[model samples]
Target: MKKTFKIPMSILMVFAIVFSALNLSVFAEEKESNDEYNFELVQKDDNIVIAKATHENGDELYATLDKATSEITLEAVEKPKGLLKFGDDKTTKYIVKAETIDPALDVVDVTIIDETTKSELRISPEYVQAQLPVLVPVVTWGGRALLLWLMEHALAMTIAGITAYVATDLISDIRKSNKNYWPAWIRNNNVYIGGDAFDTDYQAVGWVKTANSGEYNLWARTEAKAKEAANKAAGTNVWHQGKPTDGHYDHYHPAKPLVTDPWVVKLDNHLWY
Candidate 1:
């Protein structure tokens, strides 16, 4: 009999905690790396605190603190060019204000607007804690190991999945190109553009079926010519909107233009829109 390894609950808990911390650390690092604030506490004394602030993208914001009264004031020297998301959901836009003042010690006051509803929200460090998800360890069997493995190789898995999808799409395209083979008649029949000569109000109408189960793109010089061409091509004198009576040629159909020296279809053997 083969013995299966079952991870201990304590060890599983430890593994979960470690993985959670690593995941959180990575997310935090990414968020911090995207920090737009270049602001830092420069000087603090009994009377005042001064901080120089700049945006990562060159927009400037400055802050100052009054130590005696424990008041901090922040202001934007120049408005940030686009919208800025400060919270975790990243659905909020940081509103550019001329001034911001801290009401008490260890606290900074700021105004941010929700991007969707355009509602104003006042947020501080304390209220922002709820934005982070609480990491809880779930008990599992051998699957816990698989979870750890997947977490370790997430990037590789993602790349493999994308490559597979792209290869599938490429294969489909190749098969379609192979199936779009043109018949001998389509290859032989040359497009004739005669509408411009016969009448000023003439145009090319819909395609008519040919003798070889193929199709020929035809342009009519006038309404009478259009009716005549339809009758000759399909042995039917009826058109979609009946026979056009007015001299104005309203029944225009899409046609592919000739590409080669003999005005033939393109190499792909498909009609150009």
Candidate 2:
């Protein structure tokens, strides 16, 4: 018969405890999250959008909604410390005066710059796709928000044909409501909804054909007016009603002309009249 040596139960118990401790350490290592992003962009309300960058983790950033370009701008702000709860600071708010949102592009058209060198900020494509859609709706307008949202959905629903007809009647009732009046040049018609050309409010309208950007119509019969209106309506950028001699940047000032009129001939390197 072969003699067999018995293993100690105490040693076996010690080995078992060691194995369990090793497994727990491995589990913790797997559970730790990779939070490398610098800011968390969140929409607090319909008119409240902000980026949180406190303590560890995000790039120091602030957001701007430019009224002139109808787009959002992201700038590098001094990284703030401690807790930044919503509505605590005015600097975090996104709206500039008379801001307009471009509905055709993704949720918001974000532009960033290298203020250090005045160049475009280098960012990955992954960031654009991940963040822009859920950002910057923190604008306050009662019906205009609804109108813009409807327009965005309408644009998304059809790209080529459906929108051409659907857009015209989208906001008919809302147009008559006095509070939400930002004059848009009425598409395919010669009339305006909220007011007239002589009203002289700061109009910030975008060029859109396939969706809801149509507003007030034209009453003037002059060829210059017609051409200006056409260029404004037909999606050509850099065309708007000009400021008058009085230096007021008002719309369609009668007997006054554009900063650079499409009709006027310049005296540079050409035949002078």
For candidate 1, the 10 contiguous residues with the lowest summed lDDT are 155-164
TM-score of each model, in listed order: 0.21, 0.24
Estimate, for each residue in 1-273, the C-alpha lDDT of model 2 and write its tens digit.
999999898887767666644423224221111242233444322332343332132224444322223233343333322333223332322222212233443222222343344443222223332232212212111112222343333221112111121223323444344332223332222122222222321132222222332222232223344334434444232224433233222233112223575733211110000
Q: Pick the candidate with the highest TM-score.
A: 2
Rate residue 176 of model 1 by lDDT. 41
Off by more than 4 A, model 2: 1-58, 66-73, 77-106, 122-273
lDDT for model 2? 0.29
Ten residues in a row with the worst lDDT in model 2? Answer: 264-273
Task: Tell me the tens digit of each residue's lDDT in model 1 across 1-273.
Answer: 999999888887767656544434334422322244444555644455454544454444334434333233333343323223222311122232212121212232344333345544443354443343322111011111221222122111111011111121122333344222111111112221211121222222223443222233333334455455444433434333322223111332222335565442221111211
Angstrom error at residue 260, model 2: 46
